[model samples]
Target: MTGMTAEVMTPKEVETAKEAAIAPKFVTKGVDVYYAEKQALTNVSLDIETNQVTSLIGPSGCGKSTYLRCLNRMNDTIDICRVMGDILLDGADIYSREMDVVHLRARVGMVFQKPNPFPKSIYENVCYGPKIHGIAKNKAELDDIVHTSLQKAGLWNEVKDRMHEPGTGLSGGQQQRLCIARAVAVQPDVILMDEPCSALDPIATAKIEELIDELRVNYTIVIVTHSMQQAARVSQRTGFFHLGELVEVGETEQIFTNPKDERTQGYITGRFG
Candidate 1:
């Protein structure tokens, strides 16, 4: 399949191509966010293409995670966090008062920095999302979703015989993959990951990276990572954030080899974080 192009074209040509090309699954425009009175993001605009992995990289407190949370409205859980501007999913603004937080989260799922599986069994953990979202009509359907999700996550072979075991009992890497399987159970259109491999070793990290590549065929993925190598390995596109602003965004190869902005160059070149 042909990927989306950043080539400049006339308005009419762009419109025609846009119609022919797969539209962005997510669009954020002029998005500003604040925690209490302190601004955390400033006029951040971007498009997350469908069926591709997009990585957000930068120094700590650069608003990468904050911007990610905004996609699924996870910031709504924080009382002091306020957001302005628009975030659209398939052309509808998700921040609108009419949007349902429960439904929105199901459509846009998340995996945290540390794997936090439920106390339940592995099978239950994978089935929980489908159960909560009412995606499964019955026990048979729930089992099918659980099996499919685990297979997609590349964990089915490892844990298929131990479905009744507690998810917390698995190794760190296994638990992380279990979390990914749980996210997939709901059949989300987009999956948001916040430093998903920060706790794992290199081998586990490699496994997760492979899973990320496979997952992009079915879900739009947005990852916030501190590891430059990890970002380069997994993402199709990369966004560099600095001081609460999105400094640059381009193909992963371009961002690494030839950054357009000084700040991005500094970050990637070991001059600064």
Candidate 2:
């Protein structure tokens, strides 16, 4: 046809563009947090889209985890922590009195920095949430949930024969994946992970990263990590936090290669963090 230019798009690129056009899964506006008058997060606004991985990256004590806690109202557990702002999940206010904290948390499940599997069998650990939430109507139903969750977390094959063994008996990586299975068993719409691989060995870390990539296909995932390389590798969108503030947020490649803010550029480039 004539002289023309065309842009090549990969599968991930196409998915990212599709999600960008949809309404975000969660929207936070002008959120602020204080720990007994000492501010931990400044006015922060961000959006999380569905079926995608969004990463929060920054140095130590930069309020990344604090901001993540806000998603599921985890901050409310602390007596000294106060959060003020509008955070909406699926167009409803998560902080409203009309919302039940228990149900809200069920909808937005969390996996912490360290693997904190229950002191129970692996099967029990995965079924704990569904049992408490009454998500299963019978033993057979609960069994199915447990099986599917473990399979989704990529741990079923290794632990199927040892389901009755303590979750702590598994390797560190398996324990983390077990915790992830527990989270998935709840049938949550969003999964929040705070440094899910911080304590794992390289092989374990790789497995967790692979799981994260797969999990994003069904659940909206948000991860906080100190590893910039991990963030670049896993996230479609990345947010950079600095000194209790969100310095910048954009596509992962753009944030890594061409940050608009000086603070973001500095952090990503190792100039200062």
Candidate 3:
């Protein structure tokens, strides 16, 4: 044993190392939100993996949307809102003073509860983000970005011939897709959707669900949905929130079928929200 050594790792240890190498896209710990004197979220901690759909399912006002907005600092728009805790994107603090809110929002785009496309033409609706973010330099570049974004959003063929038409002129589903296209045009690493299909018909909702599944291949998606069925259909991971706290989180299948927490089981069984 003249200063010689041999090292070996078991299969379990090797797997643990591999998992540790791939960090989560977003890591939130002890996040609390306040609007004036009222507390909205309390000590919530969660890790959102990259390129996966993570659904937040709970009753209305459970702070699901509040947590989603925290990812991009959307709550800052509210005069009385204040957020505290650590939120990390790519292991960097998103809530730090050095973080640029505008750029952070560009990296983490949002789709609202309703389809709120700009009043501009469909092309403009998709082009605006790229233009403002300087993602496109010239006419041809802008055109390409708009086209590609629409394609990613699964609305290209439906609206290609109507690029110049007002975005608001499209049907509810198409308009929602247009809003998604707008968010994609910014080339975000993450997308936040808040009850995106609540206003659409069942058919349209199905289409949006399909698009969400497809988009997860390239972008990390966090969706706040009231429909447990939608969450089961679209997400790989699911988190149950109740009364401003995260009750449980796990694989979508496991969460719905065999939740560890009784609260999760009760909610899944329709006992209570």
Per-model lDDT: 0.93, 0.91, 0.91
Q: Flag clash pairs in model 1.
A: none
Model 3 ranges off by over 4 Å: 1-21
lDDT of 3 by residue, 1-273 (tens): 011114586888668645643678899999999999999999999999888899999887889999999999999899999999999998899989899999999899999989999999999999998898898879999999899899999999999998999999999999999999999888898999999999999999999999999988778899999899999999999999998999999999999989999988888899983
Q: Order the candidates by lDDT, highest first — what do you get? A: 1, 2, 3
Cα RMSD, model 3: 7.9
Stretches off by above 4 angstroms in model 2 are 1-21
lDDT of 1 by residue, 169-259 (tens): 9999999999999998888889999999999999999999999999997788999999999999999999999999999999999999999
Name every residue pair that clashes in candidate 2.
none
Per-residue alpha-carbon lDDT of candidate 2 for residues 42-144, written as tens digits (9 for 90 to 100): 9999999877899999989999999999999999999999999999997799999999999888889999879999999999999999999999999999999
Cand. 1 Cα-lDDT: 0.93
Candidate number with greatest lDDT: 1
